[model samples]
Target: MTSLLRISTLITTLSFSGLAVATDVVHFEGKASNTLPEAVANFSEYNDKLEAVMEGELTPEAMSEVHQLSYTLENAIAKMSKELDSLAETLEEVHLASESADTETVSEQGAAYLETSRELVE
Candidate 1:
């Protein structure tokens, strides 16, 4: 009987506690809404300064220097590509030689296997 009474009391306490928590949440949300506009203005000012710097509105000459560097990099890449083509031709010759050597080795191994088998039979 005491356990049953204690359980009911606990349930009642929990129901009231949930209502109290919900009311507090609403109050805090209202407070936040009241202050949000000032916060947004402050953030807007900070963001505008950041945008100006990142968009290079801070220096006109920086973009020209960037353009020159980009051109140089493109030329360098073209030169390197030409050199790699020559290297690829040389590597292709080496690959063919290695394939020929492999074929010769396989033939020698086959001949040696026949000779060993004949000797074992004798």
Candidate 2:
């Protein structure tokens, strides 16, 4: 009975403690970690290669089918880089929104809740 009571107390403490720092999983900074510059650089190289090949600098193909394909890849890279930048900014905004929300209070429960909430956000 004592052990049961102790376990109950521990669970209660943890549950109450957990309510303060609730982290929203959608951190709004979605996919900011995806490297864009590296990708753009690689595609730039592909575009250059395609240009050289098409121009006959690389034995300039009369048809330039491959060169055209490379051109497409370069455009795609540029588009992807722009998208990544936009996404990173969007996430920053979301993080700011979450931080700016009014959650602090003064009572013991409120303080505990505030700490927990901050922890969850952090």
Candidate 3:
């Protein structure tokens, strides 16, 4: 009986703690969506430029610029991907928090997500 009581107490503590960490999910609120599309468009344009460079002469300056553009595009894609992942994870967390009625967690996560997304856009 004592062991069962201890287990019940532990479970209750854990449940409350989990609720304390979860925030509410907001819909269509972050700049992550807008940034991703812009990033994709930039990638397409960069790829087209890269193709043109490849087809043209292989001068030292041209090669250098190509290298720089490729690096920039790769970094941009990676940053955008990270932003997307952050937004998705935040959304999932918010959903779970909402299911458990953890409003504080939801609000915190939503605000953080929005801020991060805005930074990504800038």
Candidate 4:
């Protein structure tokens, strides 16, 4: 009887602990930027905000805010990563053309790469 009672108490404790963990899960509904320019803007803004919030000791409230801000940051990074992947391919074309001394291909792909890259820095 004592063993059964002990098992029952353990089960109850486990159930409550699981409930606590479930309640602690936070859901973020932040919107993602649709365009590269929008993503760049969001990435810059949220990155600065996140850095500012991390200056002091992290309280639960600050941690929660950081968690929410991370959603936008993640979205911006995803968009930028996709665009940069394409840009890298273009730059590769320029590199290969330059190596072979193909001035026409080099000029065309190099110009294309620089145009897109300038947008990213500006």
Point to the candidate with the largest lDDT: 4
Worst 10 residues of 1 by lDDT: 26-35
Q: Is candidate 1 or candidate 3 better by lDDT?
A: 3
Model 1 compared with the native: what TM-score?
0.34
- Model 2, runs deviating above 4 Å: 1-65, 102-122
Q: Write the per-residue lDDT of candidate 2 for residues 7-71, one digit (tens) a residue.
A: 99999999877765454222221112134454455466666766766667444353445635554
**Residue 12: error of model 2 in Å?**
89
Q: Hey, what RMSD does candidate 2 come out at?
A: 27.3
User: Could you tell me which residue pairs clash in candidate 2?
Assistant: 20-116, 20-117, 21-116, 21-117, 28-91, 29-91, 56-60
Identify the runs in model 4 with alpha carbons over 4 angstroms from their true place: 1-15, 22-24
> What are the per-residue Cα lDDT tens digits for candidate 3 across 21-92?
564322231112246656666666778888888898989778766866776577558767877887889988
Ranking by TM-score: 4, 3, 1, 2
> Candidate 2, which ten residues in sequence have the lowest lDDT sum?
24-33
lDDT of 4 by residue, 1-122 (tens): 99999999999999999999878878886658777888888999999999999997799889989999999998998998998999999999999998999999889999998887876777
Model 3: what TM-score?
A: 0.45
User: Which should have the higher lDDT, number 2 or number 3?
Assistant: 3
All candidates: TM-score: 0.34, 0.31, 0.45, 0.77
Pairs clashing in candidate 4? none
**Model 1 stretches astray by more than 4 angstroms:** 1-58, 102-122
Identify the runs in model 3 with alpha carbons over 4 angstroms from their true place: 1-64, 120-122
